[model samples]
Target chain A: MSDRQLADWRNHALNLESEVNKVVVGQQTPIRLITTSIFARGHVLLEGDVGVGKTTLLRAFTRGIGGGYQRIEGTIDLMPNDLVYHTYLGEDGKPHVSAGPLLMSGENLSVFFFNEINRARPQVHSLLLRVMAERSLSAFNSEHYFPHMIVFADRNQVEKEETFEIPSAARDRFMMEIPIVVPNDDAIMEALVFDTKFHNVDALVNTVQPDVLQFDQLNAFSNVIQSSVEASDTLKKYALNLWKATKAPLDYGVKVSGVDMNRLVLSGASPRGMSMMLRAARVNAWLNERTAVLPEDIHAVFHSTVAHRLVFSPVYEMRRTEIAREMLQGIVNAVAAP
Target chain B: MKTMIRIFYLLLGLNVAPQTAFAIDSQNLPDVPPGIVTIRTIDPVKLVGYTVGDIIEREVILTIKAPYKLIETSLPITGYEKRYKGQVIGIELKSVSHTKKENKDSATFDIKLAYQIFTNNVVAKNAALGPEYLNLINTKDSKDLVKYRIPNLDIAISPIAIFGQVKIENNMSPLRGPLLLSNVKENKWLKVSIGFLALSLLGLLYILGQRAWLPRMGGTFAKTHRKLRKLPQSPEGLKLGVAAVHESLNTTASMSVFSNNLGIFLAQKPNFSPMATELQQFFSLSRQVYFEPNAAHGLGTNPQQWLQSFVRRCRDCERGLTPETSTQKSGS
Candidate 1:
């Protein structure tokens, strides 16, 4: 694609963000990040509380970017087979088989939201991890490819009982783990409480214009953006240092109070995580109408892209949400850019 | 002839007794019994240049036999001048005191006498502390009075100046006003001390003050600019320059400084806020040099020069000075 065509698509991507913003109030950053993920062709993991509008935000995004959509509620007894297909009783008193949400959407599936993902069994998570990692699955003695699909999963942090924690390997497969926080502004809070439009989530999500971005063309355009956005040698070194800091923050002088930095990380961001970070940063740069990737671009996606991939020691894992946030902040604060 | 000369010497000794001997006439007074009184005197060391008001001190240690005690009233009184040939002399007894030590068989007296010169002359002249006659009474025989004498002290006195016209040519300058001390050296030292104090104050201002008028006022960025100036325009030199700036900003912010959290850095150290735009440009230039070396710097033809200028402005900002806004450019 030419620069002009990319510029045109950049406008469209921004338009899609504005359309989602129209329904999802005070979530501009996450919306921008989601837009970047779409163009980067990476899956997202939305984390939030029980009623902080995580589903509403994703639904609004699906509305703007028209494609096959699928929703599934994770449950304790959910089996891997439940995602492929399900067996049901027909009126003829015979067993009837129908494709499940994963296979029902087929290759055109672009947004697959698994709500309360932690409530699902590990077996279901394993199957989903394979699909998320390879974008292909094997079932029914055949193979299925979901080249255009991007998974969006959200789990409430308020609950932990009977919920299986997503393991490190599964978490690493995701391109980003975005935190969905309710807007803290008093006016926005007041609007959320009393605004009539915000009361009906379905109507609010439906308010977004549909199909502002062509979902099928996003893959090709993602490649174009990744190729066109130039990253300087200096930026590469900086990004390399950022990656190294995640692994060995002690060497970079990254310190968090009341935590031993040496034993903080069992593992750093993986190579794939760093690549996805750069890919998303490039999209961010392109979205900002720049040709070269700046450190600011990396920062825009740093915590979202890299924080989840860090495996803290089991001692710190209980406070992963707080410590991971501090560790990432300390990394950026300690590692100098060019 | 030898016997005649001996007789003359004996007569002279009789006329003027030895220094510590009694020199009183015994015609009208009963003489002290032989071995009854003995005197030893200590006088002033300087014997010449006795001008008016010069004091001569003499101490007499007298030992007298038992039953013969010194009558205190017989001691010489202050303000008394001795007579020689019925003429009052230039020396006056200023003070007299005595302390006594008594034993079973004998008693000793320690006498201290002070005399003052009351006269001067046009020429040097001889002077004397005249003799003192002290009486001793026998306690057993009240009617018997014995006289003991303290010999005179001999010294020379000189005038302060000659009596007649003195020539200025005789190694003497005309009398001038009271002496005034020269302060040329002191004045020179005072000026030097003031100069050093001013220099010390200026040095303190340069080191500790927040002004940019002096070198090293903004030490971090100033040092960075110095390093950048020496760097070549080569790719490696550019990286080194950018690294120098990064280190400087890190030190200024007291943490690793990147373009993203620059606002926080500025808020922490408001001294660098004026060059916020230039600082942003520096990060962009740094990124291009170290991270995006292939892309054109887009900071005019010589990006190294641009970096030097940018760091210079940052130095200004670090010094709490307003950065020159005219040089602001988009680093992209």
Candidate 2:
């Protein structure tokens, strides 16, 4: 792709960012991550406290990227088939079979968001994982494919009781796990709390222009960006260093104040996860108006892409977020940038 | 013309028996010499208050009538140990001297002797100095060998007193001893400790100089970090921050850090691998602030903080503070 073409793509991404920001104020990180994930053609896991605009951010992206959007509220009683088919009584007291959200959207389902996904059963999670991994499902004696589908799942970390936390296998399928943190700036907080438009979620989401970005063109755009972006040999070495640090930070001379490097990470980020992260990084580079991928671009999407893929030792699992941040910082601090 | 005279000498022995009375035997030699010699001891023969290691000295003067020459062979010599009644007296003769002078009618002889006492013999502590016989050969008449005696110079040598007690106040009190002579070991330890202190001082100075704590000692990134720390919250300060990073990076990489060879530079110095992204963004921010004049780099919050942190990391890289950068120094 030409520089001008990349610029046009970047402009579209900026527009999508602005459109999403209209409803989700000061959530620029989530918006950029979600946009990059969409361009990378990978699923995302959204995690944040309640009322921090996870749903709103997802809705804004769904509306901004013109596609059929589907949302499923997870519950303990949710069954595996609930995502593909629903059977209920009709007015004539006879049973009726209809397509569920996953099947309903069919080929055009570009964005599928599962809210409070941990509330769902493990069976439901396994089914979602299949849909996420394959992007197609055989339901009602028919195979349905979602060629442009990108799933967004949210887990309520506040109340974890009676919740079936997403397993590591399912979690690793996600390209990024973007946390929707509440805006800490006074202006953003004031706008969120005092502004009438922010009080109404539906109206707030409506402020963004529908189909501000062409969702179908993202796959091609992602391919062009990945192929065109220059990752120098040194940058690859830098990435390898980062990879090694994650696997064996002790070998790289990484030191986190209280955590033992040898025991910090049980398993390093997967190679598939690394590639996905690189893909997202390229898109981020394109968004930054660069034809060549820079180190910042990689860092921009680094933690989101790789944090969930890393398995911590059981002892550090409870303090994963705190220790993981340190461990990642250690990696960042341990490797030299070009 | 000189008159002829004959002299006779008398010697007496001392007794230190349990009876506290002094006894002397009076002997009269008829016409032995109407010119008998009279010997007077300058130092008293009966001595007092002599400690165990004390030396006893005595000077005796003998006067003889005319026509007499003192015998030189009668002088006491070193190694002459005195004994009392077959028991060893503590005194060992150190030296003795004999001198004679002629006068109008008489010849006077002076004799001097000294002794050092070593051990404290309990039986001999109060004993008298023992007597020894000397043969005085005549100078004129070579065949004449007269037996002469020097009376013992008695002195009281008290055993070294033990009148006081050594009271120890604490466990750290010094132990009594035959004092040790250890100046050699003390000198060696002193040299070692001084050398250690000197090395420590030198190391501290090196660190201070390397850290640019000393005046005019500019190390790598020393100026950069200092300027960043003292940077004012102004546009000019921001420019300075940018320029500081640029200059330091160029110096660290030993070349320009354009986008093309950034990898090559970092590859050459893998120590900077961890800071790959931060350095990239630092260049971006520099470009934005200086070239494009964009006040904001979309760095989320606190652009000044971002600049400061970037500058600090840049400084850390320059100084090899980070582990990745530290490897560079260690490799060499």
Candidate 3:
């Protein structure tokens, strides 16, 4: 691609991030990381308490991109077939095989949302993993494609009953797992609760122009972002070390208070997690107009890129967040300054 | 009448002269030989003596009772010089001393002498020919004995006398009397000094050998020398070293991951291309060793060597890419 075209593609990605920020208040960091992942052609997993605007933020992102969008609420009864099609009889007594939400949206579907993804059975998760990894699904003797698709998943943290935690294989497929918390500031919280527009997800999402870019152009745009972005040796080692630290925190000089490193870490991050982190960091650097990645870029996206990838010891499951924070701090400290 | 009176005065002067002559003659008698020297009458003789004055001089003479040929002779001495004027006075008398008790006969004479008392020079002008004297005394046959010219003088001799018969014997054996006499002449202090010098030379040789061999035996110094030799020489090598350290420090930051992606692109070893063979090898080794179980265990005793080799290859890969061009290449 021409340099101008690459530049325009980068500009468009940054514009999308800004556009999402307008509707999603006080979530610039997550928005940037999510945008980076999108441009890098990787999926994301969002975790938060209810009413954290997780769905709204994803909707804003999809609206800014302007392409076909699908949202599926995960339930224990949700089966692999449900994501593909439904065999039913119509009111006219005619048998029909109608495409499900995942397939009905067609090849142009740029954003696929699976709300409360952990609520879905492992069968559905397995299917989602395949779709996310390959960006294509086979059903009815045909291969359906979603070449430009970026899957945005949210897991409900408050409830665990009947919820099946997404297996590592499925989680690894995601480029990052971002946590959407209740805004800490009273003002932001107040604005979120009292603002009538914020109460209406559809209205807030509709504020941006839909179908702003052609679906076919996104792959080419993402490729340009990847090519135009540069990452230095310092940044690369920092990320890899962080990824390794998650698996073996003690080895990286990270010690969580009250948590025994030897007993608290079941395993470190998989190589796939590291690959995802670099992909996301590269896109973020490109958005920042930096030919080389800076330490700030890596630090800005570390938690989302690495936190969910950690497999904690069973004894430390109740304090995963505390352990993860300690682990991350240890990693940050263990990795030398660039 | 006047001539008769002058002759009477002359006769008186001559009578006084005769009394003066008699007094001079009484004081000029010859010295008698010591009775101990005359009593020791053996075929061969041995004697030991010491110096008694600032300068002692003696003349010895021997008169044989029979027409006998000169036989072997010797002077065995300790801490004494046999000197006449400025020269060593070697044995001149045949069969001067010999042993008779053990038919294996031998002879020895010891004379303990000192330098002139008033001089600062204490070293003897010449060494006594004691060994030659012992050789002559040990010879058995009288026909083979050599005679020595005798000089007579008023000699002061010790009362002790040593005498024996001449016979053949092993002069060098420690059991022999000659060996004891020679050992006395070699001072104990001199023997100790010679021993110390020999020991010091051996110690010096040992230190030199250690210096020459330790490096070849792979000591710590050798290992350090090898490391210094292998250090990078080029600007690219220096850049890579700095880069590796920087990356190692910033391990936790996301920038490192991003940089690695750029490194991968810059290294350009996708599908193991020929130009980036070393990079491909390094990547493959890291993956196998890090990701595959038991790979480290398989490394055996040479883990450091394997690790060092891996690090070096990675450095080589890193150095091949210029920082400015690497960014451009990765972006492309």
lDDT of 1 by residue, B56-149 (tens): 8989999988789888778888989877777876888999898989988889889999988888887667777867788888999987888877
Q: Between candidates 1 and 3, which one is better according to lDDT?
A: 1
Question: Which rank order by lDDT, best down to worst?
Answer: 1, 2, 3
Model 3, residue A324: displacement in angstroms? 1.5
Q: Give the candidate number with the greatest DockQ.
A: 1
- Provide TM-scores for the models: 0.70, 0.55, 0.51
* Alpha carbon lDDT at B86, candidate 2: 68
lDDT per residue as tens, model 1, A96-214: 99989999988999899999999999999999999998899898889998888999999887789999999989998889999999899999989989999999998898889899999
Per-residue lDDT value at B95 in model 1? 93
Each model's lDDT comes to 0.85, 0.73, 0.59
Clashing pairs in 2: A335-B273, A335-B274, A335-B275, A336-B272, A336-B273, A336-B274, A337-B272, A337-B275, A337-B276, B271-B324
lDDT of 2 by residue, A174-225 (tens): 9998877777899988888888888889988888889888878877878888
Candidate 3 ranges beyond 4 A from true positions: B1-332
Worst 10 residues of 1 chain B by lDDT: B170-179
Better of 1 and 3 by TM-score: 1
Which should have the higher DockQ, number 2 or number 3? 3
Residue range B283-326, candidate 3, lDDT tens digits: 33332232222222333343334434434333322333211211
CAPRI class of candidate 2: incorrect
TM-score of chain A of 3: 0.94
